[model samples]
Target: MMITLSLSACMLRQASLCIPGPSRTVLRGIHQSGARCSGHNRWSKIRHRKGAADSAKSTQFSKITNEIYLSLRPPASPDPALNPRLSAILAKAREVGYPKSNVDTAMNKALNPNEGAALQSITYEAVGPGGQVGMIIECLTDNSNRCVSRVKEQLNKYGGRMSPTAFLFERKGVIKLSLDPGTDRETAFDTLFEVAVEAGAEDVKVVLPTEDVHDQVGGFEVITPPSEVSTIASSISSPFKVIGVEVAYLASTPLRLPANEEDGAADELETGEGLGDVISEEVADKVFSLVEGLEDTGDVVKVWTNVAEV
Candidate 1:
């Protein structure tokens, strides 16, 4: 009798741990996947490490350097206090492990027009596989032809084509903020929304905890009109770490797959049984590969796409 009682208790305990209202197969799958219900976990640690390494690499360093140079281009003072954008870019450069010497050199070039090559800003649009994905590539280069050629070459190589994606993507101001450790979620969100609306923001998105949340650096994504980004970002009060203030290409609508190409079953939606999507791992990998190929171009700084994660 005691043995049977103990077994019942054990089964009940395990059942309680399973995601609410899912079958045993789902529970088993979650277990096999090694997913955790809580925010802090081994997966989170791995993601954080990967993000740090990626940010400190050559491409990221170059991007930050360009940002610093461009931020100082308005004939504004190099003193960060005088140019908030300059301050933000410098902070980013330092965060990415860029050398202080390099930072100073870039600033000097920006300050003295004759000191460096004249670089122009260029944007290229491309359509990805099945015209389901759209991308906008922003580049700062001294040679326009070289930049365009490089971009076109990459697009052709990756089954993408140069086309106008502006209709699909609109430029919006994005302000990202990271929630401080131990902060109350409700309070933080309330404060963020209030500040954003007051400062002319259009929408606020809570960066949902995802398998990639482990890789994400920020906790919230705030959006506003292109002209209002800086003002809105500056108004958000502290305790929340403001990550970046910039203009980005935000998709006006999602790109949906045809029924035959649709990945994953309706049952897998919000199952909490896995770290990522219900889509077969193969499709997800292909999508990311296409995006990464575009971003890897020497002159490509930012690549925005409308590809929806399945």
Candidate 2:
């Protein structure tokens, strides 16, 4: 099944990518196969057999339970758009079939003054295989050491290590305009180009890939680094439209791996689509195992990878 990342409103919730001034939520769900919304045919479900290759069903459940609690705040209108992050969290939770009672209990706790726990968002940056630059792995957590250990272990086992790689990827605030027919592509595109340039946009791309050029939901993705996120967002100065904003990870220089048909599961070496055989499935398993275990620690947050192989 597709793993949904639904959380309540208060705790750790939604995919709030950076858009200029502050972070804005893109909704709640995983991008195993990036979709426009939760209502889509999830390819990840088909990619992984039997829910998970491993039998850590119980352990995974426990971790998601914590995530739900960490996702929402107290009480809810139960709508996502009005409260995008929380709404998405609930959607993800339901998709996972988390107990209804557990969901309700979490809502109740959000309003419960006695239930006070502040979760901190943590991000880790590291260099991976092939001298490729890295990504920022952001997570919501309460501890740091636990997160660090998991990171170190994975890096050592994998073909890389961590350091101050936050600068490797330019950070920025972004607003993804998923326009409908009502929104004109030409006008919208022209407006965005103007607005983004004025806002100091480092980059922008029409996420929908097609020849017809107009049948996709993913719209123009605007990028701005951290310092300019807020400024650009405010200067855009719109009154009513929902211009979603959040800091996002953008590769400074994308690496293309070399395809080696003999080794499809390529490793650290960055190459074009088929140039390399990726890191072995076993290695991926190890990395996921360590990452998931670290996630359960509740302190370690976010993991980014340029590990071309896996």
Candidate 3:
């Protein structure tokens, strides 16, 4: 009698296993004849990486599309020139390479709601693991029940739970004004402060560009009462462009991670450097993950957190 075995194509592609012939039975133990199939391994890695990239792109596109739809609703104009919010969103869509087709579709849907379920805006509040951190999540969705369930799932997944976190924040309007190229930072700040104050802005401060690779220029962030957002934006003089305006829930008292003995002293020393508040690297990462997870849910439009800094 003779015994033989054959490896499947898929198994062979993962690892090259060999067994000696009968004559060399003593050395019959299975051996890896070669390293893992490089071609197969490489392709697998490429596929996974591409999948992740595609997922991120899809999420971004969805968020942008929702924003476009919201901007086209009543009280907001479909014409970009007359609607600052819509204008800003369109600019952002272009910057992000959101397909024109999607934009057109969202606009059509907003213009003709009878063709689909009406979208609703909902806000959910949550507290972090230790109740030290609070978050405000804003969502726009056609299915409120599904949206609420998805949000709650994400919250529980990250050790968070729905709670009344609204009291921890203050609702106000934020306007981002772009500065002219080559403007002196100090002079620009002074001018912005003066003009913003005269125009009913509650506070004005320099805001650095976000993490977006395409955004290279920093600007002035103006805070105002919700009613004054439009007034202040229009009141801004030349050399500055009103890039974005939105009503947002700003944390009244931002929370910092409790400093441990090892990093506490170091954090205290750097406190005067304008770092505001400090969070442990580990906790910060979790906080960020929780926020991102919420944002990835199609309905979530914005996630506001009380965390001062990572």
TM-score of each: 0.69, 0.49, 0.72
* Candidate that beats the other on lDDT, 1 or 3, i.e. the better one: 3
**Cα lDDT of all candidates, in order?**
0.57, 0.44, 0.64
When sorted by TM-score, best at the front, the candidate numbers are: 3, 1, 2
Pick the winner on lDDT between candidates 2 and 3.
Answer: 3
Cand. 3 Cα-lDDT: 0.64
- TM-score between model 1 and native: 0.69
Query: What's model 2's TM-score?
Result: 0.49
Q: Per-residue lDDT for 1-310 in model 1, tens only? A: 0001111221222234333333323321322111112222222222343333234378677777778766776655577755556666777777667899999887787777676678788988887655556778888888999999888887777677888889987789877677776777556766665666556677665443343433233356677788766666767757776657778886666343222212223112224322222233333334445556656665767777663322
Candidates sorted by lDDT, best first:
3, 1, 2
Report the Cα RMSD per candidate: 11.8, 11.7, 22.1
User: What would the per-residue lDDT of candidate 3 be over residues 254-302, giving only the tens digit for each residue?
Assistant: 5555444543332332232322455555565566667767888889988
lDDT minimum window of 10 residues, candidate 2: 30-39
Clashing pairs in 1: none
Better of 1 and 2 by TM-score: 1
Q: Report residue 115 deviation for candidate 3 (angstroms).
A: 2.9
Give candidate 2's error at residue 61 in angstroms.
8.4
